[model samples]
Target: MFKHLLPRLRERSIAAKRPVSLADMMEEFWREPFASLAPVFRDGGYPAVDVSETEGVVTVRAELPGLEPADVSISVENDALILRGEKKFEGEEKKDDYHRIERAYGSFSRLIPLPGKVKEAEAKARFDKGVLTVTLPRDAAEAARNIPIEGA
Candidate 1:
């Protein structure tokens, strides 16, 4: 039960857009019958995303601090951009707890909806300064075009 749930809970909470408290979590644990199976969003999500479309391309920038290229994976599947990665907490030693511990480490996955058709083989990804930028070149046929306003 809890053995498999803790990880999921942590991931969901981290993915949440707003902060969730311990009491809230406890209340959810007791009241929500589907809590275990539900996706929870608490706040301070991982790998925050910024997406934009311009110049025949869709750009996705995700912040992945403390992660290496090998720790992340990006792929295109059926008009969707999938991002998968894991953030590990390296080393744990006994420490005096007088303050606060807020950093979270775990696996995260986000599926972004594509703005247009993309050439998967022509896509490019680069990682620098803990940020992963993926650019998907849009298909020529699917590129956006401006419509000139015609006054009659």
Candidate 2:
């Protein structure tokens, strides 16, 4: 009956030995009241992305399964690339019996910072087989240039 007390005692003993900061105490004070509701505010980082630079272009690819191209929007603002989209829930069929539904459906927005300036007018995006590919060509002024070394 008292087996659980051992673990609690050990935990308290271990915790008492460590130095605690004011910030840690404050965080614990605030966390206990909202710990049960924490899951509701979690961001799962949906629609994962990959950003790569090759030659004179920067490319970004996002995984958006089960969503049409029309459901998403892409924009470049203030040197950051923004991706916004919503995956609406499908109407449940009366005959379908489901045990568990883990798929996430909702609106999400992701802002990606670019390494260098890009030509927004020349930017192109394509969606194929649940993947979005965006290519932004680097601006002429932002391109890499070889500097000549002068011997004095």
Candidate 3:
């Protein structure tokens, strides 16, 4: 989606040796069928994620509609949470029999960085109702420390 477009836009801007304007966008994908498909090309990809933090835990939820728990893989590396998975559709007939193909089916990997630090060892994850939730407990030393205020 928008995530995939930003990098291409930045690269195009760099290669053009100037800033990208609205007119530039029009001219870049300027063609007969290509021009018509300009918008689709810019917006196409996987689901989005929501992250929240409580006093002791950081939770990550990713939208993965139409997928089973086994279809996705989650891991942690350094300060980043890694998600790897594929969205696939199969039929008893064949792949070419489809009349229309709108849904994206392929492998994707997304790395989300933690807000601060967490105890990866104690992290837990669960997938249910097409939502993947990961709860990461804040590292003991990295947890917020409250300081007492004194009257001067």
Candidate 4:
């Protein structure tokens, strides 16, 4: 989706001090739409996630239905938050009877890039119901600040 790469293109444009044309953006989209997303989609994007920031804390929430807290592992590595887990659901078995199972099962790992540096040691995680929430306090020095314009 173009929306997913808009921010990246904008950042690149700013860094290069040049405007990114629509054609350029489209070229990038066409070149590799699935370059980074192939793995995620291939695995069904399990445990769908939502990342948000509030005040000085960055929160990552993931939907992990049918998974127990013990079955999941959370870690921050290589400037990314890594979530790894397995989902296992066994179908009922009756003597000499075949049953069709229509549920997803297997292992999955999701890597989410951090917007800025975070206090990894101070991070906290909570799992309630079928959701997993991780809160990481932003490193003050790495937090975003507005730049003042010099000319009118």
Candidate 5:
């Protein structure tokens, strides 16, 4: 159904272009807000992330391909987890045989807020197989404060 409708839509667009009025141009402009935002999406940035919590600990995993351990930094401050990294495209700088290029480069930072205070000293991070994982242990006292209240 959509395949047959597409040609009619294109024909209508062509006919509509004949005497483009101010209202028609305004309608076209309002219809596509992302056309001017293509450059922002093209910039390689912000690696994907996944976070999980178990018991008193939270584990965060991020996918960072083509990045080394030294290129990444993790920090926690005021219950906020911060992950920052820079991905550099490293290959021979030759002027030949380049088909397509679609990878993000430069620095990206992701900050995740924890629900409660965590044990900073027990936090650990490891990177393996292009995946970075951080383990955060919650503070024992804060983790045990949620006692169920009985009906009065």
Candidate 6:
């Protein structure tokens, strides 16, 4: 009995050293192939977005790494704020020996819808240390509008 159990324990130990079984790999392969190829945004590959509203001003913050100030473009159209940029990779690599690669390199765009109309001339943006912060102040006349509702 003891000898039989020893063989079984050794088999289990050997199985643990192996990478993965074929059945497991096939199950994962069929599950979601694009899951591994998904784009990584800031904040663990999820787009970093934050919005704050003051008495009359709204602030938006986004994190964009590996980008220069000139590489980023911000535009407001139809009350939607668009942030677009490209994170480029310009490193020399040997064709024969590339062990691993995990960093993301490509263009990314983030669209943020403003809660209220903003003054385009008064909007401000600053990028520092991979973080971009945008401040949009609302127009005073537009901010003061209070639509009265008639009872239906």
Best by TM-score: 6
| Better-scoring candidate (lDDT), 1 or 2 | 2
Index of the highest-lDDT prediction = 4
- lDDT tens per residue, model 2, 1-152: 65656566556655886325444455465857676565655554556889999988999999999999999999999888999999999888889899978788899998888988999999999999999999999898977679999999
RMSD of each: 11.5, 8.8, 10.8, 16.0, 7.8, 7.8
* Cα distance off (Å), candidate 6, residue 56: 1.2
Candidates 1 and 6, the one with greater lDDT: 1
Candidate 5, number of clashes: 1
TM-score of 1: 0.63
Model 5, runs deviating above 4 Å: 1-45, 97-100, 144-152
Q: Write the per-residue lDDT of candidate 6 for residues 15-68, one digit (tens) a residue.
A: 886414454445456876655555442524324779888988889888887788
Q: How well is each residue in 2-90 modelled by candidate 5, as lDDT tens digits?
A: 56665566666679764145444455669875766776864532667787888778888888887889999999987888888778777
TM-score of 5: 0.65
Q: Write the per-residue lDDT of candidate 4 for residues 44-139, one digit (tens) a residue.
A: 656789999999899999999899999999999976899999987665556646565557798989898888899999999999999999999999
Estimate candidate 5's RMSD in Å.
7.8
lDDT of 3 at 52: 90
Which runs in model 2 stand beyond 4 Å of their true positions?
3-44, 144-152
Q: Candidate 3 on 6-75: residue-level lDDT in tens?
A: 7787788879886486544655556343766656754542458888998889999999988888899888
lDDT of each: 0.82, 0.84, 0.80, 0.85, 0.78, 0.77
Q: What pairs collide in candidate 3?
A: none
TM-score of model 2 (CA atoms): 0.66
Model 4: ten consecutive residues of lowest lDDT: 92-101
**Model 1: runs farther than 4 Å from truth?**
1-45, 95-100, 144-152
Q: What is the lDDT of residue 137 in candidate 3?
A: 90
Cα misplacement distance, residue 28 of candidate 2 (Å):
19
